[model samples]
Every structure is written in C-alpha cells, then in structure tokens.
Target: MVRSNDNITSIENIQQAFRGVDYICSKQIATTLYLAFRLNKPILVEGPAGVGKTDLAKKTASFLNLPLIRLQCYEGLDESKSLYEWKYGKQLLYTQILKDKLNDIVREKNNLAESLEAIHQYDDIFFSPRFLEPRPLLSALQQRKGSVLLIDEIDKSDDEFEAFLLEILSDFQISIPEIGTIAAKSTPYVFLTSNNTRELSDALKRRCLHLFIPFPDAQLERDIINIRVPDLGDSLRFQLVSFIQQIRKLDIKKLPSISETIDWARVLLLLHADCLNMEIVRSTLNVFLKFEDDIAVVNDRLYELTQQATKEGHA
Candidate 1:
C-alpha cells in the first residue's frame, strides 16, 4: 500500500487520496493540486459560490493529515489581522509585574546616560516571541509539520491586503519590524479561493497557480449527488439532479449549486420522498432558489420542470 505522503507522486494518487476522504474531484482539480504541491505554488481557485472551492482546501488537509488554518478575507483586511499582532495587554501586564526589577536596573547605573542604555536591553524582551501573537498566516508558517493554509475569499479583501500576501506567497516568509524576518519551518500547502466578486490584480495573480471550478455538468453533478447524498434512491436522485440542471438553464438571480442539491436530497430523504412530483417540487422550490422572484419564475414553469425531471428519472 502506498503511504499518504506519496499522494504527490502523481495526480491519480491525489485523486485516490481525496476519494479516501470522501471528496470527489475532477481530473482538472486533481492535476492542479498535484502541480501546486510539486512546484510549491499557492493555488488560486476562482468560481461562483458553493462550487466546492473552500471544501477542496479542507478535504486536501483531511487527506494529507495536516492542520488546516483558514484566514477569512473581507473588505478592509490587513496584515495585523491575517498575519500577526503584538500582545499589548500582555506587555502592559509585564511592565507592571517587572516594575521593581526595571527600577532596580535603572538605579544600578552610575549615571543617567548609562541607565537609559541599560534599560534598552530589557526593552527587547517586551517585543520578543513571548509577546508576539501569531495569526492564521504566521501560525501556518510556524507549524513544524507543515499545514494547509487557506486564504478564503481573496477577492473580498482589499488590493493592499492582496499585495501584502505576495511576499509570503513567493518566499513563504514574513518580515516583522522589530523581529526581522521569519521563514516557514516547513512550506505550507496554500489555497486561495475567490468568488469573482471583483477582478484580481495581475501582479497578485502571477505568484500562484490558477484554477476555476464552475457548476458541474449533468454527469459530474450526478456523480457528486450520488457521493454526497447516497441514501437518496436512484430514481429520486436522478430526478433531483435533472431538475437542478434544468433550473440552472433558466434566467434567474441565483442558480442552484451543488450544495443546494445535496441539501435538497437530504431533505427529501428525511421527508420520505421517493420521486419528483409537482406538489413536492412546488413545496421544496425554496430549498434551492433563494430569491422570491426566482422562485416565482420557477413556479410559472412548475409543470414543465416536474414533467421533464420525472421523465428523465423514469428513463
């Protein structure tokens, strides 16, 4: 049997490893991840929401048996939050506790000039490792056994924050003003997901490998539905996926993604639904479609959708 560490040996190995963890992935995803591992490059995954971009990093960590550290990005994110910050409260408490010791050192000096110089040595202790608070990025780099560092939703962050990541993405190191530079103990497997809310910078894009995960096609969606909602009967599963595929075709504010399909399937299973019917689809329409306008649009075509999906299920 091949060890888990050998997952990077080939793309197939990565696929098998992900399968072992119950994460079904396509050849493109497996290949990109394999290349990222071999080249030590971060993967930039761009896609619409709920297409498994975040889950990929989590499952990668699960299969690899590495700690997963995630930094959720949003507007106004900065280095102090994602990377590191000093523990000011702890430093203040230390100052109070060491007041006598600090005073004794200052008094021990013969003159004012010498005392001030002597206190500088103790000043270094306040800014040392003990006072440093490691955030997700720094915590990932500090892992002795390596980790899966997921920078989730990079597009949600500001341009400056994205630029801030370039140094770590390129060299796996971060520079601190007082502490100087700190390199990774072991290079982490990095994944940055984007929802395409905004266009990313070209310079930021250059440092990493890129991948896009669109909504799965019929066959792939079927396979995913099978894996994720296994207890759903074949007839119901077929009808459910077919209905979702049809729904994606319509003009709507939000199309049902894979996650919604899984949720609908599980809901059907709980409700003891064996197959698709007009009443069931009508009642459960809200499970997948979020907008009232979208639901109304689907309601207009309710008969058409139920007939089509049921025909496919029967076939």
Candidate 2:
C-alpha cells in the first residue's frame, strides 16, 4: 500500500504504486490520477466496458488505503436513491414514541395557535441526520477520513440525475431542503465511469477532468496476463494474448476485454494447457466470446487464428 505521507505526489510514484498491486496502467492513466488527487477534482473516465474503468477506482482506494464507496447507476436512477432519503420507518417509530411527549407539551398551550407554535419548534427534529439515511453520495461526504467515491456507469442514469450530480461534483457538497447545505468533512477522490450509452451534458462534462481508457496494446496486455496468471508458461501466455488481440480486430458485438483475457489465461492454466492448439482453442472459445453469434463467427475462423498463433510462437 502507498502510504499517505509517501511519494504519491508524482505521476511516476502513482504508476509505481499501481504496479505494486499488479494493475499495469499507462502514463496517461497515472497522470490523470495524479491530477485528480492534487486538484481534488472528479475524474470522468470514459471507456468501453471491461477496460478497467471501475477497477481503476478500486485499485486507487487500495493503493491509498481509503474506503471505496460505489454507486452503481442505471436507468431511472434518482437523487433519493443515489443521495439521501428519510428513514420513514425509523421516523414513524420515533413519531409514535414521541406521541406522549407531544400531548404533554400541547396540554400546556392556551389554544390552537399556541399548540401550532409548539409543534413548529420541533419541526426540524424529524429531518436531522439521525433520521436521514445517507446514500452513496451523502455517505461519501460524511466520511471524515475521506474516501474514493466511484459512480459507476453514469451514462445509464437519467438526465435529471446527471444534472443533480453537477452541484456535488463541482462543490463537494449537497443541498437538502430540510438541511440547507451539507458540506464534505473531507473532500473525497471522486471517479465517474461511462460506457457511452448516451451523451453526458456539457455542464456535467465541464466540471470533470476527462480520461478515455482504450484497450491495452498487445505488449501491455501480455504483461497484465503474466502478472495476473503467473502460473502460465511464457510460450502459452504469448500465444493466448496474441489470439485475443486478433479476436478484437474482428467485427463482433462485443470484443474480449482485458478482464476476459485474464479469465482465458486462468482457464488455460487450470486445464494444464502449455500452448494454443486447434482442439483446446475450440473447446475454450466460450471463455473468450460471449454471444452465440460471436461464438459461431469465431468458430469459423478458429483454425486460422490457431495457425497464426502457432506461426508467431515459432517465429
């Protein structure tokens, strides 16, 4: 773990820390994380699915030794779900428990006007933080030690929700009608990921530092496989990564991600396969491709892919 008082102040240090955790990242990613930490700005990490956008946040938290608070966004997500909501059941029980006290206070009141005034004095009691169930957004703010706040897949959320995030992202605070404003005790390192399901608003984009994480190049992919699946032989590792790289070049519904590459590597390790071959590749094609159509397409080209991998292995 990278200590808080250590060398994380530099981009090179950031890269070294991530590498310590076996997460091989490019210089651009290291720089983005460095700036996000130094400037205390939210990072808008846009990339294809399974390219390690979400993993970046998790690894940063582990490297920094901070808690990771994740809010998984989806269609129809709203402020109440992502932010805070009143604990209605708890509030109701409290209200029931306070009924006797309320009656006793009202008994001393002269008339309806006095009784109303008495009730108004305690109006804010129900809306306090005790009864406020803090969701991911609000919970991040309340962390005195700070945290890594990851809003995963923000593009899946509604436009209204995106607009709501603008204030929090910019100011590190949230506004509640009951409570005028709730500022962060300690500003958290924030990261928002998008799969590009829809275009985010310019206002939202303007407030964040943007980064695009594309698929890793062949060498980087191989390094990642080596680190993650160390039990595999060097020969098999090269052939497997090369095969996946070739698969990504095809026109498919979903390309195999870095995660899938690691998965395939592990599967091969478990099967005690030393190198890529037609029979083994055919049997494990499902490990790389997801859709049935993608499987059929790769099946048609499997022999050729294996031949190419074999030629590269001997070269």
The Cα local distance difference test for each model comes to 0.91, 0.90
Clashes per prediction?
0, 0
**Model 1, 241-268: lDDT tens per residue?**
8999999999999988889988999989
Q: Top lDDT: which candidate number?
A: 1
Report the lDDT of model 2 for residue 179. 80
**Lowest-sum lDDT 10-residue window in model 2:** 1-10
What are the root-mean-square deviations of the candidates from the true structure over C-alphas? Answer: 2.2, 2.1
TM-score of each: 0.97, 0.96
Off by over 4 Å in 1: 1-5
Candidate 2 local accuracy as lDDT?
A: 0.90
